[model samples]
Target: MGSLCFNDGVQDDRQPWWKAATFYQVYPASFKDSNDDGWGDLPGLISKVDYLHGLGVDCIWVSPIFESPQKDMGYDVSDYQKIYAPYGTIEDVDALIQTCHERGMKLILDLVVNHTSAEHEWFQESRSSRTNPKRDWYIWKPPRYDAGGNRQPPTNWRGYFAGSTWTWDEHTQEYYLHLYASEQPDLNWENAETREAIYEETMRFWLRRGVDGFRIDTVNKYSKRTEYIDAAVTDKNSPYQAAPEMWCNGPRIHEFIREINQVLAPFSAVSVGELSNTPDPKQVLPYVSTRARELDMVFEFSVIRLGNGDLFTGKYIYKPFTLSQLKALTEKWQCFIEGTDSWATVFCENHDNGRAVSRFGDTSTPELWRASARTIALWQATLTGTLFLYQGQELGMTNMPASWDISHYQDVEAVNFFAEAVASRNEQRIQATKHGLSILARDHARLPFRWNEDDNVGFTTDSAKSWMRIPREKGISVESQLGDRTSVLEFYREMLRLRKRFQGVFVFGTHTLLDRENESTWAYIKEGFLTTKDGHRMRGRALVVMNFTVERAPLVDVSAALGCAPESTRLMVTTACGAVRGAKDELSAWEGRIYCDFGPEICI
Candidate 1:
């Protein structure tokens, strides 16, 4: 290995696969359909290896595909080691993994270990009798009795999907804990036998089968407080309560992760934990710290919180995510992780949230919509971490159709909120709530990946009824944008290609937030060195300046730091093509650019 210019011009060189890779997330059920079943299966995904390769991503992070009761759409795992029947057989999954490797793309599966489907064999046996050998595999406590001898739930904790966290088990005469749906029972990580069994049967099982890595689902909620305490009631009538302090990043979370990491280390497996709602950067560092032996990185929700209108309520409210807010959150993470062994996952949208273009972009006009997509791409691609692009993101997908009825929404979160709102019988509130949800629903991203402008948006045969409605009228199909010079898809392709061309500057350069107090504009500088194969070296500075708002903003000068006149800097990439100007040129609405003192050729 040669020297990494960002670390030094001569000696330090450590190239972890994840550190240099760009990740693409695919919601398996919405990617493709080979047999016209209206549902995407492993074979359907296997058939799209070329398309993924063409997109220039280094790896694909697939959502859960385990055998499930479909209670939570595959999150409720009945058998951790088996593939869902509708998705395909174990052989089909092996084939998909093999195909991705053959195409030079690594595959990362979703690891849902926090809970298992109530229909799981282990759960069934545990619920049968108190003397069952597997009785301790899940949480179970005797019901609390009131003065009148009336039975009550063990605790007043609320389920994430609504209702009480504890469900009465008549047969066993006890109450079981479920943080999610009642069909999903929380696994007892406290049991040494349970943890070891999961490691052997699930973790090592997939690693032995050539899995590249895993995206641990709900990882922050894995370890609950040993004492089952009632969460303080904030709203008595609301089905859910605020209890993150008791469960998130709990006592043994770091210990559990370190043990899991020990198992993954031998296989060279990478992992990223879904740890949302952890506000303190200090609190989040341990999960991804090299010294901690936990995860490669963890997904933080600071940016997501800004886009999510209702932080406390179910993202059922609409609040505009402003330019200033985006800057403060991103800069904090970037600065915090710099020079540390820990890392951050830079992404704007995924299966759990609406499209970034819909949440942050000006979708009211076609040019602004496209430009917003480009602006987001520029921001993510040049960030100091692994980049993740959800399916259809490259094509600049918009929110689901405004005309879509609540009936068309398929996400459990949206459905539950709608049902609860309707029960209130307030027409004004119902209309207002639904209106906000129209822009924030998770289904907006869960819709089928648009491959072409066919009758079914090229996801399936025209006659096949899709599992979820496709917004065909959006006209944002991959095929239509594949070769269009100015299309969002092409813009992404260019950004990715440039990242590969200048990996050191983008991946290892020291990050510095510029114009920290600016409200209308957000800017950052990445300074590092570029080395060539012939051993020639050039000091490089990459400047990312953006007008995040909808109004033109005057540019500022950074020529002294750039070591050259700002006007002389090379424009490596930009949402709008024009002369390189660092002093007087005003950025157009929603416009951004990547400026480098030295050209990308210096890295080569």
Candidate 2:
């Protein structure tokens, strides 16, 4: 509701659109099939830009597009300079980047620098013989000679996909390490030559092509175990374990990030790392410091781990957080990042997780979709950072059909988690792990982007087969709702409009978290978007309340509460329950609403 201004200090001028960007992620293989092939590719993605642009997303983050073995669904990059044949080539990538830029949109690639495919030329060469020049490019150790003169693995550390993290290479007579699948061997980041080469190639490849930014995968693990540490000794005789700390954010981590940042700085390219530790502001600041290191922001994993109270308990987690936990986690991160050089990468879902609509709140009802979405966006954009939107999110995509059962799951994480559970012989944990795997797997988020409720959900061929199944109907689709003013697609458009309109608040605003919540309310405030030093000319202040319930909660009237300008106390907007004929109303079972007024103060 407050008056806004760009850095020019004139309330009359507007800020650049990117200051309030909304990013949407695309998992290419399962998104759309252009030539009627079984897998989705870049050309198919080109056809969908209109849909994304129509939804008002400013940036599109496509999952790993580099040439790969598909062991981790393109994450196991074999060639940073080349493109995956199935996804298309360098020209297709160039066209995709150009198309997005022409529409005033930005593109961020999923950077998987933590490891490389064993099939890559470097790995192939490294494994050929112990004396190979590239032998030190990856982690490797001699096999432990047994009493019988047979060879044994150097350690029992298990690979995430199935067995040991180390696979013996008979040709080289050494064991090569892989944190994920055996095909994705971990790179020896400690090696100056190896790390430098990767940084040089990866940076030079995209920056030269005019791409916007990167979403670093397993971002914290760039620096890894020189000791090749052993597993944590869990039950089921589990052998795979590397306290990522032993590797994550290691001694040379900052050095590598600084180097990458050097190459990216000239391009104004943004980088956001997927972080999974405690949100200690000091620890997180350098990576995003304008003056320091790697990324522009960090996407903390606490939100995704919300429902899982105790991961080590081996529990089956299939629930969502209450309005309380949601508000708290968001508030904590908001506070920390605002005070530090770091910015936050806001999110509820991404390529490796399930959709937020189904997970955060009930979307079975239409009203819920609008309310929850608006509530989510209000909180996200108002934070001191950028935001990410996984594909189909604008249309309010939910989790994949639960009816498919375990046999249908094809994601490596899902398959591996299932196997890991089975190997433990803990039936209860097995049940829990399987269900948890479904929610946590890439497959859940990889469902075809439903352009309409067409056969294959407008993704794969009717006669041809998709590597994965498409989502079932929920009345939520792009085609049916594209032109409808009362649809979720349009809701997103309005959200982006509002965010861009208040760019300063959504970008550099100082955040203050509301302390409490009932089942109905999630509240917070953004204060410094317009300040005296910035030549403040705002009509009033901004306080936002995202009510996740239908029952109206008690309010803290700004006129009577914080004692600011009364004129600004007038309601700026309602995410739902508005007055006009087409105005949206009461959220679905778990839908939400954002109410804004005066030099505002929210009633937590």
Candidate 3:
């Protein structure tokens, strides 16, 4: 496909754009508590710049810092131009921007454009008088009529949080839409003014402030399935769709994204959509593609590796992907974006995702967290794109309070789903099954970072309790693990160093897969490294292999296809620190192996 593959072969001249960049994601609320108020503020984050740089990251991706009423932990933004009072002030944000740029690093804010807080001035005016100039800024309609004039939501489609997508306003006697929570009203992108206001002002506000990029929350939700046609009522207890094809990749999605991209082009800003429900490869392709108007990259949730269990349907499910299943998810996306400037942002855990350490392997102990984290880090980082590391992920922090009962829980979605299932389905006591909904709800994963064994896991400063309870420890603590080179944190530190060293291969390499039949392992190779910012003067090969099973799972011969004989390749890094590094046809369990085809007994 032209010299875009470049000379050295690792990076594409088609897009030498992303070589040597690494992104670290921060959940501002739990990153650091600079103030003693028990809340994590911007100043708290400022204190950790050195720590981030020390990890050798090229960029930092911070979660929402906008002004919000916080019904959804700052996701429901009240003011696009304002920072949440709890996060810190405008001065604190400026300090962060200046600090990051000075360190030669870029900062990307989490942009919540799918909707705004109900308290936003736009929504306030929309709800005031039906004839207000901004009334059309948000979707509003007359309530659905049953037998009497008594009203119901306009549609059967449920909000992500639960219940009807429409909310009633007393002042105008009309219904307003909320795809997520009632407090976060959906913006009517169909309105040119609304789109322009959000695009121009939001970009200018941050771009002028020196922010580098953004992680657009629910990127596909902007246009809605827009005919506003009634969603077929299926799954009586299910308020939403098992899959909403019409809603996710809507008609005007590309048009809206292009409008935003034009604003971002001059600044070289990186914008990745937090794409959800993109079950089809073709539908998922355009958003991250380089072919036309789309984003620089899109974050994929393949690593979440969710279980198939239908707790709501009374079916117990377990999820362990076959070798081809994972290869399909990771490689399909990789191949789709190969020719485009649009790229994929690779990650495992984030603020809303469950802890990868626990989800991938046993969370029974902190050491296991380390093993799982190391294995996962080693694998995803080897892919062809930018890297994303979530907060506390390096420490291998796990899912919150494993024993958390219904009384201690606070996730809105978790609670609402349980109530919905009970009220609508009459399922066998769903309230009692609130524990089941916790398995998939966003809250199960978004707890505070655990820094110390001391009060509040050192997440908060004052006597106040943390936003979410920290998971109990069985030998995991940053203070305790910092000095241990063999700890998970150190492993992550080294992994970053290694990937940085091989930036050309991991970031710019031509992507291809080896074996597809192996059920319990993940395998791939990055070949033909190209010249990057640094001169690449030689030929080389890099292979990534991960043992998905905790038990030993043999890998198919990937070296044979890449021109490496079994005897010629050398085994490099191992997830298990103390284990002897070797080149057996099969890998030991949960261990990841990176190989180089230098020669027999290849030199390190």
Candidate 4:
């Protein structure tokens, strides 16, 4: 193939290695249990390096494995340098890194510096006394008293988990802020010394240990609004209010990210920020733009947040959405990043989301399950960005059985929400909340990996129990689908291979959404230039079509849209079974296809 060319004065050849790489996110707790301790550890992850290498992944992003009290899992870090005992020792991490490097794959760790466990030494010292030198390291305020002399939290802002963002400390007679759980107190970025300490302890500590980079958690929430004012009550039913403006995309977020970039620049580390709070493309561009010198890329949550209710209710109340809505949200991001120096992170499932096959596709039948999984994979693989595949997703994993009760949930977010529902004593509200949780709870993705049809699904010894409940879905394990040519696992492997083969078109080509109004069909064309071995340059156009519904759908004539004859288009890949005679006029249920047309050699 020929080299990629741009209309402006940009060179695709100069792109960073990460920009062209595929990432696989490993959520350690449920990945694999090497010691049969019911929890996945670093050693177990190390043993699976070869499996990821075989999957065509170029990078591995492991979620938090740091020493913690496990209040919010490992998100509440108590020791930045020490490894979580359940996950394993530092030696295991070294082995995992060396193993990944041997196979030419990079490794990134989750950075959760926005807050630390209240048990952290710094927090312990800071809360000991108001005069302690470390008191300023965390955000703290004096409690406000009402007319009746009852002490109240400084502000009416609600925490991400629930309740007020502040927790009163009787020892210091002051309230400290925590945007998340109270045990996870928010760090004060206003303190220069605090910022310096976090950088030295977290970022530099790992970079020196040979880790490639970081997946910064809540990256935009580090710099928060300093004014300690009450958030206007948007939901009057609740005492506290959602305050994204006060704590998200704060005044100093860019400055903080620039400092982080400086620390990462020396190591040439890649930074993919979790910018959940900042959804606007214009607002997020500076963080990832080449000229801005901030993050390399950031994960946007708009697509994931679709079909969800308000912030307080969150995903507890499901709202029906159309394919047009999905298409518009996707196109918005794709077009926003086209000409800009910034990049995007293409993903449908993660540690915090329900399985893609269950949420976005049909799972009413076995055939539809596999087809929809392949369709979703095709859609993500063809997008212009870094791809991240969560574990078990390649096997078309679905959510936990809807019949399971709240006792099976181990996630703090889900358990807390359920507790609130039960506390209300409203049976109707309780039933609705439980039904919603069955569909959208984060615990759905926290189940043990299904390796085979053994007890505990081969995640652990047959005699041992896994950390979370294993799904009862049949014929969805790796061992079952590994040898099947038409299985979801095989389709993922094939799709990823094709993506790597045509990186120029799939990763850097211009994207144009076709038939944006269609609710059942998603069609888009990617146009770019490819070079031949004999030094001739040719323009290449790739058309991707997907039937997003569970029924047959007629797609737009992409050949006519691209001004190319039907016979000239070559069938590159398809999820359809059996032999495809020629160009297709309509797609079968959940079918996806890609066609490539390389016109006669042309010079720009």
Leading candidate by TM-score: 4
Q: For model 4, how does the per-residue alpha-carbon lDDT over 515-536 read when each residue is reduced to its tens digit?
A: 8898889999887655554555
List the candidate numbers ranked by TM-score, top first. 4, 1, 3, 2
Off by over 4 Å in 3: 1-19, 147-149, 238-243, 302-305, 308-324, 339-341, 365-367, 422-438, 461-464, 530-537, 553-561, 565-567, 579-586, 599-604
TM-score for predicted model 3 compared with the true structure: 0.89
Distance (Å) between predicted and true CA of 266, model 3? 2.7
Q: Which regions in candidate 4 have their CA more than 4 angstroms from the true location?
A: 1-12, 579-583, 599-604
Instruction: Give each model's clash number.
Output: 0, 12, 15, 1
Q: Candidate 3's residue-wise lDDT over 490-577, tens digit each?
A: 8788888767665556665667776667667777887654332334344557788887766667765756755778777766677776
- TM-score (all chains, Cα) for each model: 0.95, 0.88, 0.89, 0.96
Candidate 2 global TM-score: 0.88
lDDT of every predicted structure (CA atoms): 0.81, 0.69, 0.71, 0.85
lDDT of 2: 0.69
How many residue pairs clash in model 1?
A: 0
Q: lDDT of candidate 4 vs native?
A: 0.85
- Clash-forming residue pairs, model 1: none
Candidate 4 backbone overlaps, count:
1
Listing every candidate in turn, what is its Cα RMSD in Å to the true structure after a full C-alpha superposition?
2.4, 4.4, 3.9, 2.2
Better of 1 and 2 by TM-score: 1
Question: Which is the leading candidate under lDDT?
Answer: 4
Of 2 and 4, the candidate ranking higher by lDDT: 4
- Those runs of model 2 whose alpha carbons end farther than 4 Å from true positions after fitting are 1-19, 144-152, 156-159, 231-237, 309-320, 364-370, 461-464, 530-536, 550-552, 555-562, 565-567, 577-591, 598-604
